[model samples]
Target: MNRIACALAASFLFASAAHAQDWRNHQERAQDRHEVRQDKRELRDDRRDVAELEAVLANFDRARSRGKEREMVAVESQLRQLLKQELVEGRAELAQDHAEIRRDNREVRSEQWDSRHGGDRRDLRDDRQDRRDDIRDARVEAASQSARKNIARELSSLMGSRRPRDLQRTRTLIIDLIQLARKEVRDTKQEAREDRRELREDRREARDNRW
Candidate 1:
Protein backbone atom coordinates (compact mmCIF):
# COMPACT_ATOMS: atom_id res chain seq x y z
CA MET A 1 0.00 0.00 0.00
CA ASN A 2 2.84 2.40 0.75
CA ARG A 3 4.43 1.66 -2.60
CA ILE A 4 1.13 2.36 -4.34
CA ALA A 5 0.75 5.59 -2.39
CA CYS A 6 4.22 6.78 -3.45
CA ALA A 7 3.47 6.06 -7.12
CA LEU A 8 0.18 7.92 -6.87
CA ALA A 9 1.89 10.92 -5.35
CA ALA A 10 4.50 10.90 -8.11
CA SER A 11 1.77 10.83 -10.74
CA PHE A 12 -0.03 13.67 -9.05
CA LEU A 13 3.11 15.79 -9.04
CA PHE A 14 3.70 15.15 -12.75
CA ALA A 15 0.11 16.04 -13.58
CA SER A 16 0.32 19.21 -11.58
CA ALA A 17 3.49 20.30 -13.37
CA ALA A 18 1.84 19.65 -16.72
CA HIS A 19 -1.16 21.69 -15.67
CA ALA A 20 1.04 24.58 -14.56
CA GLN A 21 2.94 24.58 -17.83
CA ASP A 22 -0.30 24.62 -19.79
CA TRP A 23 -1.60 27.48 -17.68
CA ARG A 24 1.52 29.52 -18.41
CA ASN A 25 1.06 28.84 -22.13
CA HIS A 26 -2.51 30.03 -21.89
CA GLN A 27 -1.37 33.29 -20.31
CA GLU A 28 1.31 33.75 -22.97
CA ARG A 29 -1.27 33.29 -25.70
CA ALA A 30 -3.48 35.90 -24.09
CA GLN A 31 -0.58 38.32 -23.98
CA ASP A 32 0.21 37.68 -27.60
CA ARG A 33 -3.39 38.49 -28.48
CA HIS A 34 -3.22 41.78 -26.62
CA GLU A 35 0.02 42.72 -28.35
CA VAL A 36 -1.47 41.93 -31.73
CA ARG A 37 -4.37 44.23 -31.03
CA GLN A 38 -2.00 46.98 -29.97
CA ASP A 39 -0.01 46.54 -33.17
CA LYS A 40 -3.17 46.79 -35.24
CA ARG A 41 -4.03 50.06 -33.60
CA GLU A 42 -0.52 51.41 -34.25
CA LEU A 43 -0.74 50.32 -37.89
CA ARG A 44 -4.00 52.19 -38.31
CA ASP A 45 -2.36 55.31 -37.00
CA ASP A 46 0.59 54.77 -39.34
CA ARG A 47 -1.78 54.40 -42.28
CA ARG A 48 -3.21 57.80 -41.52
CA ASP A 49 0.24 59.31 -41.10
CA VAL A 50 1.32 57.88 -44.44
CA ALA A 51 -1.69 59.32 -46.21
CA GLU A 52 -1.28 62.77 -44.74
CA LEU A 53 2.45 62.89 -45.38
CA GLU A 54 1.93 61.73 -48.96
CA ALA A 55 -0.57 64.52 -49.51
CA VAL A 56 1.77 67.05 -48.03
CA LEU A 57 4.61 65.93 -50.24
CA ALA A 58 2.39 65.98 -53.28
CA ASN A 59 1.40 69.57 -52.55
CA PHE A 60 5.03 70.52 -52.13
CA ASP A 61 5.81 68.98 -55.50
CA ARG A 62 2.99 70.86 -57.14
CA ALA A 63 4.09 74.10 -55.58
CA ARG A 64 7.67 73.57 -56.66
CA SER A 65 6.58 72.82 -60.21
CA ARG A 66 4.60 76.04 -60.34
CA GLY A 67 7.59 77.96 -58.93
CA LYS A 68 5.69 79.04 -55.83
CA GLU A 69 8.95 79.95 -54.10
CA ARG A 70 7.27 81.44 -51.04
CA GLU A 71 5.00 78.47 -50.47
CA MET A 72 7.89 76.04 -50.97
CA VAL A 73 9.96 77.84 -48.34
CA ALA A 74 7.13 77.56 -45.81
CA VAL A 75 6.70 73.84 -46.53
CA GLU A 76 10.41 73.13 -46.29
CA SER A 77 10.68 74.94 -42.98
CA GLN A 78 7.78 72.98 -41.58
CA LEU A 79 9.21 69.75 -42.94
CA ARG A 80 12.58 70.43 -41.36
CA GLN A 81 11.03 71.06 -37.96
CA LEU A 82 8.84 67.99 -38.27
CA LEU A 83 11.79 65.81 -39.17
CA LYS A 84 13.77 67.11 -36.19
CA GLN A 85 10.97 66.09 -33.87
CA GLU A 86 10.54 62.82 -35.73
CA LEU A 87 14.14 61.85 -35.10
CA VAL A 88 13.55 61.90 -31.35
CA GLU A 89 10.25 60.06 -31.58
CA GLY A 90 11.68 57.57 -34.04
CA ARG A 91 14.52 56.67 -31.69
CA ALA A 92 12.08 55.94 -28.91
CA GLU A 93 9.88 53.93 -31.25
CA LEU A 94 12.81 51.86 -32.43
CA ALA A 95 13.74 51.05 -28.85
CA GLN A 96 10.19 49.96 -28.22
CA ASP A 97 10.25 47.75 -31.31
CA HIS A 98 13.47 46.18 -30.13
CA ALA A 99 11.87 45.23 -26.82
CA GLU A 100 8.67 44.05 -28.43
CA ILE A 101 10.52 41.90 -30.96
CA ARG A 102 12.41 40.17 -28.20
CA ARG A 103 9.23 39.58 -26.26
CA ASP A 104 7.45 38.32 -29.37
CA ASN A 105 10.27 35.97 -30.20
CA ARG A 106 10.29 34.61 -26.66
CA GLU A 107 6.58 33.96 -26.89
CA VAL A 108 7.00 32.13 -30.17
CA ARG A 109 9.65 29.96 -28.60
CA SER A 110 7.35 29.26 -25.67
CA GLU A 111 4.57 28.30 -28.02
CA GLN A 112 6.87 25.91 -29.80
CA TRP A 113 7.72 24.38 -26.47
CA ASP A 114 4.04 24.04 -25.64
CA SER A 115 3.39 22.23 -28.91
CA ARG A 116 5.47 19.29 -27.74
CA HIS A 117 2.97 18.69 -24.97
CA GLY A 118 -0.18 19.45 -26.91
CA GLY A 119 -2.67 16.75 -27.79
CA ASP A 120 -4.03 15.45 -31.08
CA ARG A 121 -2.99 18.02 -33.67
CA ARG A 122 -5.42 16.61 -36.20
CA ASP A 123 -8.36 18.30 -34.50
CA LEU A 124 -6.42 21.44 -33.64
CA ARG A 125 -5.99 23.04 -37.04
CA ASP A 126 -7.18 26.37 -35.73
CA ASP A 127 -4.75 26.18 -32.88
CA ARG A 128 -1.92 25.43 -35.24
CA GLN A 129 -2.94 28.20 -37.61
CA ASP A 130 -3.07 30.66 -34.77
CA ARG A 131 0.45 29.78 -33.79
CA ARG A 132 1.64 30.13 -37.37
CA ASP A 133 -0.08 33.49 -37.56
CA ASP A 134 1.65 34.62 -34.43
CA ILE A 135 5.02 33.81 -35.91
CA ARG A 136 4.24 35.45 -39.23
CA ASP A 137 2.89 38.57 -37.57
CA ALA A 138 6.01 38.91 -35.49
CA ARG A 139 8.20 38.83 -38.58
CA VAL A 140 6.00 41.34 -40.34
CA GLU A 141 6.10 43.68 -37.38
CA ALA A 142 9.87 43.47 -37.19
CA ALA A 143 10.21 44.40 -40.84
CA SER A 144 7.78 47.28 -40.40
CA GLN A 145 9.75 48.63 -37.49
CA SER A 146 12.98 48.46 -39.43
CA ALA A 147 11.41 50.33 -42.31
CA ARG A 148 10.16 53.05 -39.98
CA LYS A 149 13.61 53.52 -38.57
CA ASN A 150 15.06 53.78 -42.04
CA ILE A 151 12.46 56.34 -42.98
CA ALA A 152 13.31 58.37 -39.94
CA ARG A 153 16.96 58.20 -40.82
CA GLU A 154 16.27 59.51 -44.28
CA LEU A 155 14.19 62.31 -42.88
CA SER A 156 16.94 63.22 -40.45
CA SER A 157 19.55 63.37 -43.20
CA LEU A 158 17.37 65.59 -45.33
CA MET A 159 16.74 67.90 -42.42
CA GLY A 160 20.45 68.37 -41.80
CA SER A 161 21.18 69.13 -45.45
CA ARG A 162 18.27 69.88 -47.76
CA ARG A 163 20.20 69.65 -51.01
CA PRO A 164 18.45 68.55 -54.20
CA ARG A 165 19.83 65.01 -54.16
CA ASP A 166 19.06 64.62 -50.49
CA LEU A 167 15.52 65.81 -51.10
CA GLN A 168 15.11 63.23 -53.89
CA ARG A 169 16.33 60.47 -51.62
CA THR A 170 13.97 61.54 -48.87
CA ARG A 171 11.16 61.48 -51.39
CA THR A 172 12.06 57.90 -52.29
CA LEU A 173 12.14 56.88 -48.64
CA ILE A 174 8.75 58.44 -48.02
CA ILE A 175 7.23 56.51 -50.92
CA ASP A 176 8.78 53.27 -49.72
CA LEU A 177 7.57 53.77 -46.17
CA ILE A 178 4.07 54.52 -47.46
CA GLN A 179 4.03 51.30 -49.42
CA LEU A 180 5.26 49.34 -46.42
CA ALA A 181 2.60 50.81 -44.18
CA ARG A 182 -0.13 49.99 -46.70
CA LYS A 183 1.10 46.44 -46.97
CA GLU A 184 1.11 46.08 -43.19
CA VAL A 185 -2.44 47.40 -43.04
CA ARG A 186 -3.58 44.87 -45.62
CA ASP A 187 -1.80 42.03 -43.86
CA THR A 188 -3.32 42.95 -40.52
CA LYS A 189 -6.77 43.06 -42.08
CA GLN A 190 -6.22 39.62 -43.54
CA GLU A 191 -5.06 38.32 -40.18
CA ALA A 192 -8.12 39.78 -38.50
CA ARG A 193 -10.36 37.86 -40.91
CA GLU A 194 -8.48 34.67 -40.22
CA ASP A 195 -8.71 35.31 -36.49
CA ARG A 196 -12.48 35.64 -36.68
CA ARG A 197 -12.85 32.47 -38.74
CA GLU A 198 -10.58 30.56 -36.41
CA LEU A 199 -12.52 31.82 -33.44
CA ARG A 200 -15.74 30.46 -34.85
CA GLU A 201 -14.11 27.12 -35.61
CA ASP A 202 -12.58 27.01 -32.15
CA ARG A 203 -15.98 27.56 -30.59
CA ARG A 204 -17.43 24.68 -32.55
CA GLU A 205 -14.54 22.45 -31.62
CA ALA A 206 -14.88 23.33 -27.97
CA ARG A 207 -18.57 22.50 -28.03
CA ASP A 208 -17.87 19.17 -29.68
CA ASN A 209 -15.17 18.35 -27.19
CA ARG A 210 -17.52 19.04 -24.32
CA TRP A 211 -19.47 15.96 -25.31
Candidate 2:
Protein backbone atom coordinates (compact mmCIF):
# COMPACT_ATOMS: atom_id res chain seq x y z
CA MET A 1 0.00 0.00 0.00
CA ASN A 2 2.87 2.41 0.77
CA ARG A 3 4.47 1.73 -2.61
CA ILE A 4 1.18 2.30 -4.37
CA ALA A 5 0.65 5.57 -2.47
CA CYS A 6 4.16 6.75 -3.39
CA ALA A 7 3.50 6.02 -7.04
CA LEU A 8 0.19 7.89 -6.92
CA ALA A 9 1.81 10.89 -5.26
CA ALA A 10 4.50 11.12 -7.97
CA SER A 11 1.88 10.91 -10.66
CA PHE A 12 -0.15 13.66 -9.03
CA LEU A 13 2.90 15.86 -8.72
CA PHE A 14 3.80 15.35 -12.38
CA ALA A 15 0.28 16.23 -13.46
CA SER A 16 0.32 19.37 -11.32
CA ALA A 17 3.58 20.52 -12.86
CA ALA A 18 2.23 19.99 -16.35
CA HIS A 19 -0.93 21.89 -15.50
CA ALA A 20 1.09 24.85 -14.21
CA GLN A 21 3.30 24.94 -17.29
CA ASP A 22 0.27 24.83 -19.57
CA TRP A 23 -1.27 27.71 -17.67
CA ARG A 24 1.90 29.75 -18.03
CA ASN A 25 2.00 29.15 -21.75
CA HIS A 26 -1.61 30.16 -22.10
CA GLN A 27 -0.84 33.39 -20.27
CA GLU A 28 2.08 34.09 -22.61
CA ARG A 29 -0.13 33.60 -25.66
CA ALA A 30 -2.84 35.80 -24.20
CA GLN A 31 -0.31 38.56 -23.53
CA ASP A 32 0.88 38.42 -27.09
CA ARG A 33 -2.67 38.74 -28.33
CA HIS A 34 -3.14 41.78 -26.11
CA GLU A 35 -0.01 43.38 -27.55
CA VAL A 36 -1.24 42.74 -31.10
CA ARG A 37 -4.53 44.43 -30.29
CA GLN A 38 -2.76 47.42 -28.73
CA ASP A 39 -0.52 47.85 -31.76
CA LYS A 40 -3.50 47.82 -34.10
CA ARG A 41 -5.24 50.45 -32.05
CA GLU A 42 -2.14 52.66 -32.09
CA LEU A 43 -1.90 52.29 -35.86
CA ARG A 44 -5.47 53.44 -36.29
CA ASP A 45 -4.95 56.47 -34.06
CA ASP A 46 -1.77 57.47 -35.89
CA ARG A 47 -3.47 57.24 -39.26
CA ARG A 48 -6.31 59.41 -38.06
CA ASP A 49 -3.92 62.02 -36.64
CA VAL A 50 -1.91 62.05 -39.87
CA ALA A 51 -5.04 62.61 -41.93
CA GLU A 52 -6.08 65.49 -39.73
CA LEU A 53 -2.62 67.05 -40.00
CA GLU A 54 -2.75 66.84 -43.78
CA ALA A 55 -6.10 68.58 -43.83
CA VAL A 56 -4.73 71.37 -41.68
CA LEU A 57 -1.71 71.67 -43.96
CA ALA A 58 -3.99 72.09 -46.92
CA ASN A 59 -5.92 74.81 -45.14
CA PHE A 60 -2.67 76.58 -44.29
CA ASP A 61 -1.55 76.38 -47.91
CA ARG A 62 -4.76 77.99 -49.10
CA ALA A 63 -4.40 80.78 -46.55
CA ARG A 64 -0.78 81.37 -47.57
CA SER A 65 -1.65 81.57 -51.26
CA ARG A 66 -4.40 84.06 -50.62
CA GLY A 67 -2.27 86.22 -48.27
CA LYS A 68 -5.16 86.08 -45.81
CA GLU A 69 -3.57 87.12 -42.51
CA ARG A 70 -6.59 86.25 -40.37
CA GLU A 71 -7.02 82.88 -42.14
CA MET A 72 -3.29 82.25 -41.78
CA VAL A 73 -3.47 82.96 -38.05
CA ALA A 74 -6.33 80.54 -37.63
CA VAL A 75 -4.62 77.84 -39.67
CA GLU A 76 -1.28 78.34 -37.98
CA SER A 77 -2.98 78.11 -34.59
CA GLN A 78 -4.53 74.82 -35.60
CA LEU A 79 -1.25 73.46 -36.95
CA ARG A 80 0.71 74.53 -33.87
CA GLN A 81 -1.80 72.92 -31.54
CA LEU A 82 -1.77 69.75 -33.60
CA LEU A 83 2.03 69.61 -33.75
CA LYS A 84 2.51 70.41 -30.07
CA GLN A 85 1.33 66.92 -29.23
CA GLU A 86 3.87 65.40 -31.60
CA LEU A 87 6.71 67.41 -30.12
CA VAL A 88 5.76 66.40 -26.59
CA GLU A 89 5.51 62.78 -27.53
CA GLY A 90 8.67 62.99 -29.59
CA ARG A 91 10.61 64.27 -26.58
CA ALA A 92 9.51 61.32 -24.49
CA GLU A 93 10.18 58.91 -27.34
CA LEU A 94 13.66 60.29 -27.86
CA ALA A 95 14.41 59.73 -24.22
CA GLN A 96 13.14 56.18 -24.52
CA ASP A 97 15.21 55.56 -27.64
CA HIS A 98 18.33 56.73 -25.89
CA ALA A 99 17.56 54.54 -22.91
CA GLU A 100 17.02 51.51 -25.15
CA ILE A 101 20.27 52.11 -26.99
CA ARG A 102 22.15 52.22 -23.70
CA ARG A 103 20.49 49.03 -22.50
CA ASP A 104 21.18 47.25 -25.77
CA ASN A 105 24.81 48.29 -25.63
CA ARG A 106 25.08 46.81 -22.18
CA GLU A 107 23.45 43.56 -23.28
CA VAL A 108 25.70 43.30 -26.32
CA ARG A 109 28.76 43.79 -24.16
CA SER A 110 27.58 41.19 -21.66
CA GLU A 111 26.91 38.72 -24.45
CA GLN A 112 30.39 39.31 -25.84
CA TRP A 113 31.96 38.76 -22.44
CA ASP A 114 30.02 35.55 -21.94
CA SER A 115 30.99 34.24 -25.38
CA ARG A 116 34.65 34.86 -24.60
CA HIS A 117 34.24 32.86 -21.39
CA GLY A 118 32.51 29.92 -23.13
CA GLY A 119 28.90 30.87 -22.43
CA ASP A 120 25.93 29.79 -24.58
CA ARG A 121 26.33 31.06 -28.15
CA ARG A 122 22.65 30.78 -29.10
CA ASP A 123 21.79 34.19 -27.52
CA LEU A 124 24.39 36.11 -29.56
CA ARG A 125 22.23 36.40 -32.65
CA ASP A 126 19.28 37.70 -30.67
CA ASP A 127 21.46 40.26 -28.89
CA ARG A 128 22.81 41.53 -32.19
CA GLN A 129 19.28 41.94 -33.55
CA ASP A 130 18.31 43.87 -30.43
CA ARG A 131 21.25 46.19 -30.92
CA ARG A 132 20.22 46.80 -34.52
CA ASP A 133 16.66 47.57 -33.47
CA ASP A 134 17.86 50.07 -30.89
CA ILE A 135 19.93 51.89 -33.48
CA ARG A 136 16.97 52.05 -35.84
CA ASP A 137 14.80 53.48 -33.10
CA ALA A 138 17.38 56.16 -32.42
CA ARG A 139 17.40 57.13 -36.09
CA VAL A 140 13.65 57.48 -36.17
CA GLU A 141 13.71 59.63 -33.07
CA ALA A 142 16.38 61.83 -34.61
CA ALA A 143 14.22 62.41 -37.68
CA SER A 144 11.31 63.34 -35.45
CA GLN A 145 13.45 65.78 -33.51
CA SER A 146 14.51 67.41 -36.76
CA ALA A 147 10.88 67.86 -37.71
CA ARG A 148 10.09 69.31 -34.31
CA LYS A 149 12.91 71.85 -34.60
CA ASN A 150 11.77 72.87 -38.08
CA ILE A 151 8.27 73.53 -36.86
CA ALA A 152 9.45 75.52 -33.83
CA ARG A 153 11.84 77.72 -35.83
CA GLU A 154 9.36 78.44 -38.59
CA LEU A 155 6.49 79.06 -36.23
CA SER A 156 8.61 81.54 -34.28
CA SER A 157 9.26 83.46 -37.48
CA LEU A 158 5.64 83.27 -38.51
CA MET A 159 4.61 84.74 -35.20
CA GLY A 160 6.84 87.74 -35.68
CA SER A 161 5.90 89.14 -39.11
CA ARG A 162 4.11 86.50 -41.19
CA ARG A 163 6.78 87.07 -43.85
CA PRO A 164 6.66 85.27 -47.19
CA ARG A 165 9.76 83.41 -46.03
CA ASP A 166 7.93 82.22 -42.91
CA LEU A 167 5.07 80.95 -45.06
CA GLN A 168 7.54 79.32 -47.44
CA ARG A 169 9.28 77.59 -44.56
CA THR A 170 6.12 75.78 -43.45
CA ARG A 171 5.73 74.15 -46.86
CA THR A 172 8.96 72.25 -46.37
CA LEU A 173 8.41 71.51 -42.67
CA ILE A 174 4.88 70.18 -43.15
CA ILE A 175 5.99 67.91 -45.99
CA ASP A 176 8.82 66.46 -43.93
CA LEU A 177 6.55 65.85 -40.95
CA ILE A 178 3.96 64.12 -43.15
CA GLN A 179 6.62 61.79 -44.52
CA LEU A 180 7.73 60.96 -40.97
CA ALA A 181 4.11 60.25 -39.96
CA ARG A 182 3.69 57.85 -42.88
CA LYS A 183 6.91 56.06 -41.94
CA GLU A 184 5.62 55.67 -38.40
CA VAL A 185 2.39 54.18 -39.73
CA ARG A 186 4.36 51.69 -41.78
CA ASP A 187 6.60 50.79 -38.86
CA THR A 188 3.62 50.37 -36.54
CA LYS A 189 1.82 48.15 -39.05
CA GLN A 190 4.92 46.00 -39.35
CA GLU A 191 5.17 45.75 -35.55
CA ALA A 192 1.56 44.60 -35.40
CA ARG A 193 2.22 42.02 -38.11
CA GLU A 194 5.24 40.70 -36.25
CA ASP A 195 3.26 40.43 -33.02
CA ARG A 196 0.56 38.41 -34.74
CA ARG A 197 3.11 36.17 -36.38
CA GLU A 198 4.85 35.53 -33.08
CA LEU A 199 1.55 34.69 -31.44
CA ARG A 200 0.75 32.20 -34.21
CA GLU A 201 4.16 30.58 -33.86
CA ASP A 202 3.76 30.31 -30.11
CA ARG A 203 0.36 28.71 -30.47
CA ARG A 204 1.73 26.22 -32.97
CA GLU A 205 4.65 25.36 -30.70
CA ALA A 206 2.33 24.84 -27.76
CA ARG A 207 0.12 22.57 -29.83
CA ASP A 208 3.12 20.53 -30.94
CA ASN A 209 4.40 20.23 -27.39
CA ARG A 210 1.08 18.82 -26.22
CA TRP A 211 1.47 15.93 -28.60
lDDT of 1 by residue, 1-211 (tens): 9999999999997688567655654554565566557557756765766676677578667765776767766766766654444445445545654665465455445545555666435434445555666566666666666766677666765744446786677677767755765775686677667555554554454455345
For residue 156, give model 2's deviation from the true position in Å.
4.1
Regions of candidate 2 where Cα sits further than 4 Å from its true position: 1-20, 88-150, 153-157
Score every model by TM-score: 0.59, 0.68
Supply candidate 1's per-residue lDDT for 203. Answer: 49
Output the worst ten-in-a-row residue range by lDDT, candidate 1: 119-128
Supply the TM-score for candidate 1: 0.59
Candidate 2 to truth, TM: 0.68
Over the stretch 51-146, how does candidate 2's per-residue lDDT look in tens digits?
978987899889878988899888878878878877786687678668756765765676576567554454455557655865786687688678
